[model samples]
Target: MLTLYMEVSLTETQQCCGDVEMLFRRWSVLGLVIPTLLIGACSSTPEKEEISEQPAAELYLESKQRMNTGNYRSAIAHLEALLSRYPFGPHADQVQLDLIYGYYAVSDNAAARAAADRFIRLNPTHKDIDYALYMRGLMSEDEDSNFFQSMFNIDRSDRDPAMVRQAFGDFERLIREYPASKYAPDAARRMIALKNRLARYEVRVAEYYYQREAYVASIGRGKYVVQYMSDTPSVERALELMVESYDKLDMPEAKQDTLAVLKLNYPDNSMVN
Candidate 1:
């Protein structure tokens, strides 16, 4: 009986040892995998840190190269990243300016305008303030025009002139404040174009009133163009409309006065002839 008990005890000891060996093998596999995963995770962290710690000068150069290649979208990404990483770095101001142009290139006019405004507000005396003002004016110009209006040579004179007026005001302010700036000449030219557009818009309204036989309203619109948009090409048409409206209203003296002015200004005009 004692010998039989010892055999049973030895068998139980052998089974317990087998179970411990299997558990040790599983733990060994897990230990190898956990270290491998930890090493991989540790290795990846430095790589990300290296990428995020790219120097601002290098990033700016990369962005410039992208922009030179007309890859403005990629340039924008790099610029944005650089700005995010180094907000008060040496390239902060220039980065803001580049971002404005980048947004403009992508036709994100609202973003461009907002960037410009922020730059102006932050750096009111910046050397590139004139450039920002000019860009702001340009972004505001024709902002409401649709793709079809741009694709086809449709007349925008009859459309809403709110944006056009805002653009004109922007250009005017730029010229008024920084008359000697390099961009001032271009701004002045754009202002002239805007004035002509506004004059044309007023003339169209006058024509509409005339077509509806609203002679007094037509005369008022035409007179406004003559007074406020004197040098514009539409002034000639406005004067003619005024003369015609006055005649329709049976105001002989006013008709003769407007006719005389139109003839003096546009002698070869068909209406004057």
Candidate 2:
């Protein structure tokens, strides 16, 4: 093409000087004009085919095959490489989903959480977003979420409340956002377990003070349970302890008030009322 154009241009220039026939003979001898056009046409198709194609389905099948064979790491390797090369690959969602399970199979909680976050961020409106978020919560959940342990750890200077709060909050957020999520029942059940454990811990702490005959301290701790830990199962016991503490302190009016609250709330509780 270049050779022909150059000869044609030269021929046009030459024609203006009355040399037309000689330029055409020169272009024909070099054969540049016909060959270049044919080669250019032949080369175009392969480029277009390459651009308008994908290996996404093949990659997904290979990863799934490896996963089924119990080769999770190999599957991860394939999927991860594909993600970098084809961000909008057809198997993008499946790659992420399998990545989560693969990380779990390899006992890599950090990777599992990362994969879950990536999946959630990329597929915000995905039907499986709730599952991804829930998996993230499970990946990071710690002992502090156990209400029995949380109270003692809450004041632990070495522990970070931010991490614990985030883990629990994710579960709570999932429950609120996807109220009908399959995981919602389990999440709510976990909250109930947490409440029960915390309630028991409060009662145990109050009893410790009571056993030491620190009536005022015992009363304060019981009041703390009633005021702050009201949702816990220990509320009933703490109210009874408050009554006992007030009686020992010879505060008759406070004792009467405690008894009234206990009676009003649990009229069938003969032990306190």
Candidate 3:
């Protein structure tokens, strides 16, 4: 009887040990899974909270506040978030316009120009369409004068005139399409300045060609300024260049006629004397 009882006790002890081992295994698996589950929960919660925290109107107002404080970088972040969240919201148009200005303030001229163009394209009849056009023109003008040039006050007259010409066209369109717009006066003023810049660029090209002894090319450039860019400050220099180029080409009649026009336009010009 004693031997049988001892054997049963040993079997019971073994069973208890097996149960504990199984429980430990279960806990081990749970230990790995719980941390992973917790990590996932923690990671996803913040993003959900962030998205839910600021709705469209709040984001728009926040962006405006940042803009008011001259915190354009922050304003841009808010504006972008607002746009992404509420593309068809009530403040979409104003948000786009603000984004353009924010990009411009930070000297992100490419982004600013793109925003302006997109706004103009999407909202052709928007009440503030003229504002977009004007901003686009300003952005195009800024493209020609980069940070380095602006900081050092470098002359951009000798640079490529493509952007300048684009800016001029933008301003011209604004003034023509919205003559009564509040922004029209400013756009007109910018157009005049851009015209002068284009004329100066043409004169610079004429000077370059003349210096290189490309008399025919110089004459063409000069004549273009005289005909297309009349009344600009560069016209005087263009006329002078044309007279010189005509003389270089041994076109005496052309030279005489150009000289006569130059004298009539600029009597006190050094070339006239």
Best by lDDT: 1
Question: In candidate 2, what are the lDDT values of residues 175-234, reduced to their tens digit?
Answer: 999999988888777666544555566677777788888889888878987887787767
What digit string (tens of lDDT, one per residue) describes model 1 on residues 98-204? Answer: 88876766566888889989999999998878888888888887374544555676787898899888788888988998999888988898898789889989999
C-alpha lDDT (0 to 100) for residue 71 of candidate 1: 55
- Runs of candidate 3 exceeding 4 Å displacement: 1-52, 146-154
Q: State each model's CA lDDT, in order.
A: 0.75, 0.64, 0.74
| Deviating ranges (above 4 Å) for candidate 1 | 1-51, 142-153
lDDT of 3: 0.74
lDDT of 3 by residue, 1-273 (tens): 001001001122222223233233323432343334334423222221133457777787777766665555566788888889889998888888888877766556778888988998899998888878887888788666555455577787898889888888888988899999877888888788888989999999999999999999999999899999897999999988888888888999998899899889889998879
Candidate 2, residue 31: lDDT: 30
What is the lDDT, from 0 to 100, of the residue 120 in candidate 2? 86
Best by TM-score: 3
On a 0 to 100 scale, what is the lDDT of residue 10 in model 1?
Answer: 13
In model 3, where is the ten-residue run with the lowest total lDDT?
1-10
